[model samples]
Target: MSAASEKSTGLRIVTVPVPLSGRPCEASASSLGEILALFKIGCLLKVTGNQVLAPLDGTITDIDSSQLSVKLKADNGLQLWIKVSEVSLQGHGAGCFTRVKVKDRVKAAEVLFQFNPAMLKLAGALPFARVIITNGQKIERFETTKARQCLAFEDTLFTLYV
Candidate 1:
């Protein structure tokens, strides 16, 4: 095994929560650095309805564009940034609702906000979901062919070694 993979360590597994409840339309396993540079997450869960739920138990750190985007600090020390819709819904945070304010403690699977992806799409916005961990890299992932597999809410998204 390569030196990186040879090092012994513990594993941290995080399951997918709601809002990302829909079937995984597309997913790409990538390094945290690459994810940051893209400004777009590798996985896009295709949701049909509007109601969005929290992916993990965390505190709301920040919100923007009238609640279309949010930053959360997961209880496990994972900082997550979520974008509800595409740029079309940027300035106009229509079809979006803010359920919790900054500093609010939320539980896993809690309702964070409600939105209508269909409306955004009608307005030329590519209605989808993107999640990323905005933190310095320390955790490493070990995934093979299953890395790109579709995921559902509550499913094991991936396993991490720390």
Candidate 2:
């Protein structure tokens, strides 16, 4: 099916994967700012594998393919204005962090990248990615397509509906 066909209905949630070098922390806080603050120095992030899934997913309503950012029409009529260029990379790990590009097909439950929990702890912040809906609209009702990490759309790192 085309990427558009993979769009999840309001009743279901898609399970995006954790893109990182090492296995992601199960108990890690879910905030991007927190993650950055933890790494005081240039964090030792890892660019390891090609994770098949992305934590973010939605119908590609509008896109700046050249820029990699896309405007998505979410189930609740809320639009997510995401820029691929702004997407953060995972740091503080073993190898170099692989920079992901737009249109690179990803999957849920797959590793997107890895960060150093130790560095984050030392930096005194958390590496958590928070999805903000600029539209200022709220979704009413919906169910997750995946059961476990498959999160209900609100924009999460892994198991997200990118």
Candidate 3:
């Protein structure tokens, strides 16, 4: 199916993966221009700490060997990507800690992974973790909240309509 055709429906909600207390940074074409251009990502969430949480109820579809990146297929059919480092740092998964595996079922607010923020920083990588709709183009009706909000795990980042 086309990316746009894969959109989620039925009043699905998407959330941030980290605690809002960490001073989250939002991603955009302007703010994360280079990074987004390079990774082909449309959104991002940067936090100061290492813990990563599941942003929605979903089954793990893919996980990188380093465990720093995961792809989740939500119960509502949305595909989400959560990563510790940028695409450039994909090989550096050793600095991260992942708790789930491919095919594992997870709920929103559940702990999925953690990383050594200090180590990631030392490697010249941004500690900005991200929770994004991997198949967003296919989604037709979704509302996203403003970036830079102090959002907790399970806090609604966006609402998807069927």
lDDT of each: 0.59, 0.33, 0.60
Off by over 4 Å in 3: 1-41, 65-67, 87-95
lDDT of 2 by residue, 102-132 (tens): 3444333333333343444454433332222
Q: What TM-score quantifies how close candidate 1 is to the native fold?
A: 0.70
Query: What are the runs in model 1 whose C-alpha is more than 4 Å off?
Result: 1-8, 16-18, 25-42, 65-67, 88-93, 142-152
Supply the global lDDT for candidate 1.
0.59
Candidates 1 and 2, the one with greater TM-score? 1
Runs of candidate 2 with Cα error greater than 4 angstroms are: 1-53, 56-96, 132-138, 142-162
The residue-level lDDT of candidate 3 at 32 comes to 33
For the record, the alpha-carbon RMSD of candidate 2 to the native fold, in angstroms, is 11.3
| CA shift of 56, model 2, Å | 6.3
Per-residue lDDT of model 1, residues 1-162, tens digit only? 444544544455444444454444444421212344553223455555565567778899987744377888988887778766655354334666678888999987777777777667776665466666566276555331133333334454434344
For model 1, the run of ten residues with the poorest summed lDDT? 27-36
TM-score of each: 0.70, 0.32, 0.68
Could you give the candidate ranking by lDDT, starting with the highest?
A: 3, 1, 2
What range of 10 consecutive residues in model 3 has the weakest lDDT sum? 12-21
C-alpha RMSD of each candidate structure in angstroms = 5.5, 11.3, 6.6
Q: In lDDT terms, how accurate is model 3? A: 0.60
Native-to-model Cα distance after best TM-score fit, residue 158 in candidate 3, in Å? 1.7
